[model samples]
Target: MADKRYTTEFFLTAAEVNSQREMPLSRLVTTIIDTATAHANKLGIGFDRMISEGISWVLSRLTIDIAESPSVNRTYRMTTWIENVNRLFSDRNFEMTDAETGRIVIRAHSTWMAVNMSTRRPGDLTPIWKGFDMVDGAPSGIDNGGKLLPLSGSDFEMSYRFAVSDIDVNRHVTTRRYIDLITDLWPLETYDSMRISRFEVAFKHEARYGETATASRMAHAESPETATAQIAVADTPCCIARLHFSER
Candidate 1:
């Protein structure tokens, strides 16, 4: 039988890096998502196949820890596999390592649900689960809790208008795009002086094209290096995230 895990290599382009010459959090997320999508396609459970059946995979929660960020034009290998699956959701794991030195750069875990595209209701994944090899490894050491509470108050808030480019095959704002919007709330100086050690986000609702969404952030009083962001469209919440930073 073929191994249940999949691995792929990526070379970061100039556009994927920030002024600090390292991969930005948002772009790193996009790479992870892309790697997972490619792995799913190899397993015959990818986005194209799912959408054709009126089912679309929605990311419910994600958590990532970065030990190091690869620089522009550097190559890295991403390995992903299914850690477990239930009727309503599946837990996936990912690891990015230096292609040459074999040092691990990032570890991540994500929870996803398959939903009926038209009804927007969770769909049973039992049929597809039968074909997967259900691995017993979670390199990220993060729980797939899928819980993110809204921030009660914020120090700053920003609103953004979604563009056509933000929409994905599911006809909603892409997960990577949402992360980009959330991280954009921080100024360049923040990125220069601090590094994001951990990031957690929960997707609550879907934002469609041309919708206006607001993002708000509040630093934790107890843990000054930690903060939370709430993203909403109109009055409906879309995503809530927690970011942990450290001096670089």
Candidate 2:
């Protein structure tokens, strides 16, 4: 067969929303990854197949930029595709639109590293790329994801006990749930006091479902206005997350 491009569609539901009653940004990321994986699977190139080969796709970093919030009962369309492949990582981009107006609501950019499951380290993606066809154009360069939190320790430390439902098809905690768990650790007072202006995260390791995650905040003395947070399972750092809050 000839090289080809792929895309998939998914709908959002009320259960995915956050306290503000809009679809949670983290859930949006989850949908994107799920759709992209499905597209890859249509070509016989997906995470499960890679895992069977002793390899797995690890989301190393991601950015999600939201323009408007979707209300309950509204159906949205999500599309994802492989934008390009770097030396060791493949870049994936996603777009979400209001199904009725065709207005864009959110966009996301993510980088995934193919790693050897046995060694638990970065591995060449060439083997994986061979299984799928390449797209023709470069990724749309728009910075769709949220900004990274500044280097500061003023952020507070939070903790969450994982639930069984957090597990994905891979039998590990789903990436979206981790975002929820991390953000949930933030004090209710903080959300009431400020608005999250931007957020960024880098996933370094996977936490199995039912594990406990301790999230701690770190602030930069030089710039107390900026802060970052780190979430870990026991002593192993699972994710490095940063959130910027604009004073209300």
The CA lDDT of each predicted structure is: 0.83, 0.70
Poorest lDDT segment (10 consecutive residues) of candidate 2: 146-155
Clashing pairs in 2: 63-145, 64-145, 65-144, 152-218, 152-219, 152-220, 153-218, 153-219, 153-220, 154-219
Query: What ranges in model 1 sit over 4 Å off?
Result: 51-53, 131-139, 143-146
Number of the predicted model whose lDDT against the real structure is largest: 1
In angstroms, what RMSD does candidate 2 have relative to the true structure? 3.8
Positional deviation of 205 in candidate 2, in angstroms?
A: 1.8
Report clashes for each candidate as comma-separated counts. 0, 10
Provide the TM-score for each candidate, comma-separated.
0.92, 0.78
Q: Poorest 10 consecutive residues of model 1 by lDDT?
A: 137-146
lDDT of 2 by residue, 32-147 (tens): 67777777777576876787778777788876655666556677887776788865788877777888889987676788888887887777777766654665455645664444
* Predicted structure 1: lDDT: 0.83
Q: Which pairs clash inside model 1? A: none
